[model samples]
Target: MSVPTPRSPAAAPAPTSAAHRTLWRWHFYAGLFVMPFLIVLAITGTIYCFQPQIEPLLYPGLLRVTPQGEPLSPQTLLERARAAAPAGAVATTYTMRNDPRASAEFIFRLPSGNSESLYLDPYSGAVLGSLSVEDRFMKQVRLLHRALLVGKPGELLMELAGCWTLVMIATGLAMWWPRLRESGVRAFAMRPASGRRGRWKEIHLMLGASLAIGALAFVLSGLPWTAFWGKQFKAITTAANLGRPGDAGAGHTHAPVREGNHAAHGDHRRHGGTMESLPLSEVPWATGLTAVPVGTSASAGHAPIGLDRVVAIAGSRGAGAGCQVALPGTPDAVYSVSCFPSDPKAERTLHIDPHSGNIVRDIRYDDYGPVAKAVSYGTSLHMGRYFGLANQIACAAISLGLMALAITGFVMWIKRKPANALGAPSRPSSPPPMRAWIAGLAVLGAIFPLMGVTMLLVWLIDRLVDRAAGVPSRPVRQ
Candidate 1:
């Protein structure tokens, strides 16, 4: 819904100026562009927030198991899962749940380059079911939330939308600040007798102001997942030893000693690749750049330590149940075990030498750099995993609040717009002060290059349209 305008009583003390008009115009444009995508993100994100509760109901037989005395060894369960899977499906990772009733899950990569998860009864060694990795309902929702399920192009589009949403929030605050100044608490008051548009405006302003901080957190936390800005940000932060822990910054207890050809780089080489290169499922953001250490083949001629030994090794190193172990794929591959707990402080990752069943490298939450630590907690809070159900409710409320803002905004626009023309706010006689414009451009360019480029392009197009229409241009004042 529209913010309190210059003529509105809530903003009566403030005279309409170039800055006010300019901000309103930008607020309108940003909202218009971001509304649809915001709605989609809110819906999918809300649904995904409750995935822990929903998925169990959707796949009770596969996810849940009755603990019958001592459970089968991990190696036995892996073998049973492999036998039940499609022929030639190689087991890549095994996830051990802390809950006694939870079934063992094994991720398998089929010969056709597709991945699936097979759930087995931990006690009986019986296969319960299998699900296509990409086709799962929650996975599809996540895809839509991140990329609109259209892949890389959609990912880029969503990133742009997210960047513009920050602009929308900034301009919206500028538009609403006058009302807050003039009316104090009364500025947020709803006027039921003031008609439908007034009601929508009240709801929109109230929710928008209330949820702005949370919305910012969501956008900023989710930005780390974007295809373009995310990679650049990761690289930049990693290089600065702020986002991801480097060799000296990691503070890992046991750094793996490289042997053979890997010795040139010494212990814990920075491979400049993400954890995705390893067979990991749900990795922590802080360790995303932590390189996978290659194993020495000195003991490779001996029987390779089996999955059971790897699990025991991880447990001995404090990575107990709930850790997902990525089985070594080659002679030089080390078994990667990740314990991604709901509590960010307990997050840990370990690499075990498959040949000697020795801990190669061990990284805990403490090993992360300051920025990386902040991001780890931010991501957990963003996903509503930090404080349990209450956190979920809070996150869901914010998502629903965003949806309400979008819907109310649409209603306000529909009622205010003329049938014959675009309903955008009219431009001011003069642009915003030159210094303000320059400062804004600098901030956007430095923080969000994509938005800065597009913003300049939009400004150029507006200037061309003004020139074409013969509108006299007034110089921006200080």
Candidate 2:
């Protein structure tokens, strides 16, 4: 007797709900606004992820150097780079070479409030080239990622887009949840039987679901770097003592150090708990940490010792290889060396007193508090540093996948559009379940201030338009 194989069962039909209709309506609008900005972010972000492999190719003159003899003195490198600058230019900070064959960068400021960088041969102190802040391509890409190439105003717009993207994801998942349950294993099943539009829908949905985890990772990783709300998020995490750099569990003595320069010690009351005003997400994990003193107070002590002594201190502390010492700008500024970008766990941040070259603060990844540890690791993963090229490729793939989804979504919208009408989901019957909806999204609004403002604007306009037409909204047919 031949045994018969069991056949798979068909999926049940998904039931519709009032909440789903309301969510779908909002999700459509959110997607309409967010899709374009998301495209820009994905493109720029993909480019940035491959920057490690690309920068050398783009600006070899400013990045690479011939390794000859030992590098020149740190002081000499600074002087030569500044001297090569235009008259009245002043050098602020210079980066020590992490790679022996890499060019040194001396950051300078001009009278017009613009910043420039001078690249020099660390061995001979010869100027390689100078690049103005705005003219650099990578710098512009960075601005594009944070803002829409529009500076502060652009930043607000981008933040709004990011928040709306989150909304879109939330609503998309809501619509997908019931469908998944009803469709069973076939929830992930794709069929191209209905021609182009149907194929696009299945492809878009599946790709989006596949990319969900990575997409969320990128979004959350970026939040801590946002200008307004992101800064606040950092401050909150730090204030809660959750971001301190040190292993609290191991009972390490984390001596509190002075944070930033104050007019006097009394000024500490005003800025005591605040993180230092370091560039946003510029340094790997330097914000909200205590700043070490220069081994002498500004009023009573001698000038800080030269950079050579600090380099020696860093070398003694096992930060010699693949490390860079950032020059101190202010008289009382401490010298800091960053090492071990390859592995977040092996990372080290050593701050030295420029006055006596004393090691003031030495922090390692294991030394971070819980939140700090998460943020640190998340940042590395987000930047594609954790897994090298593979990480970059994965991020790039996610970006490309998002682009595909956006294109397919727009195409579907076009194919379904009524001649002159907006291609939105059918409006809800009666008033929306907005009371609960607002309460649920209140947290999102708080975290993203601009999103909160947008919600208010949307609610007002929605009400005004509904009342003027004086008609109950009808649900759309699938």
Candidate 3:
């Protein structure tokens, strides 16, 4: 996901032409729309990147425990959690950590359609209290970062803003490209003595040029999370066999039905057949679209395997500490075990049968297709999970740098704007050729259709407004 460093504007000769002004105008509008979102994303993203350190500090009582005797069995923890849970709440997942001080987490789906994470002391099996999944600080921040605290509509807005950010970066880089001078190491020099507008302009330029790659990384890596484009990307990758293997409906297995419970087994398969119906949370990206394989049929005269046995099964398959085991919701649902390791290469997901304690489906990093593998690593890098503390620091720096860039851009605009004028760059006397617009549209549409549609609509609106005001249209350059 790394890109080559762009040449600094200080290192190249400045291009000061009407074309540059045209590019500036585009950059200005894009920034005007994108800056606010960038600021919010930066602040929220920075907070979420340090969630590992921050969550423990914020919820020590809920997450920490005293390691007295040997830890209680996983089934014991689950039983205690279920007993403490609200009436009619169903256990969905259990998170076990190898850390002695860490409490085990049991996620439950309430009858009222809400989800809650119940913490339990591993050794004492004491109920440590439950937190509604929606109310968790880091969870809310993540939702905000992706969807602005709103739902689908907000997600689309964020996606559009993200797409426009690419445009903003492109136009900004274009405006920055010709400003290179042979200043060598001094090319990045800034002058605080310059007047207010000059200072802001220099700050904006330097930050924009320096952080363009990082900004691109953030936007591109995040595109897969967008509601529209992300779904399409997932579908395309999966269809091409370059993503998670097996179809969404391809992984289900019917359990062996008891003589009197054949109808119940049929009902379960009929109702809970799809992956979407599973109460899975925080699943790995590669397995997002894949179905959770159904467990074997509930057998008569025998009890289903215990949580400790499932844990042992996952451990035998290389899913060690920090693995989340999603308990079966229906009699036909398998025990879903997933480990999102800090190293992308170590990511693993296993679906173990609840009846026979057999490994139904085992997906590991090595099973991912090339594109899926790249995205796995890219996603890890984007969230600052890979490489541990260093990754988090780098991501935090990028997030903060983007915030600074947005602020500086806004400041420059404020300083340069006249009392009654919008300070946007003037249109070029010679309009760009039709082919240029067509080519730009084609390129953008191919890569990011949503952005291309928005850009085209904006262009049309600009033309309509200009024509309504009797603005003369210049001839397109040949």
Residue 217 error, candidate 3, Å: 0.9
Error of 3 at 457 (Å): 1.1
| lDDT for each residue of candidate 1 in 241-320, tens digit (9 for 90 to 100) | 67766642233333343422334322444222346666676888877766777665654464688898888777766787
Q: Whose TM-score is higher: candidate 2's or candidate 3's?
A: 3
Better of 1 and 3 by lDDT: 1
Model 1 Cα displacement at 136 (Å)? 0.7
The candidate, 1 or 3, that scores higher on TM-score is 1
RMSD (CA, angstroms), candidate 1: 5.9
Taking all chains together, each candidate's TM-score versus the true structure is 0.89, 0.82, 0.88
**Residue-level error in angstroms, candidate 3, position 315:** 0.8
> Per-residue lDDT tens digits of candidate 2, residues 59-106?
899989999988888777776876799888766655645688789887
Q: Would you give me the overall lDDT of model 2?
A: 0.69
Which segments of candidate 3 are over 4 A away from where they belong? 1-16, 181-185, 191-193, 251-277, 300-302, 434-441, 470-478
TM-score of 2: 0.82
C-alpha lDDT of all candidate models, in order: 0.79, 0.69, 0.78
lDDT of 1: 0.79
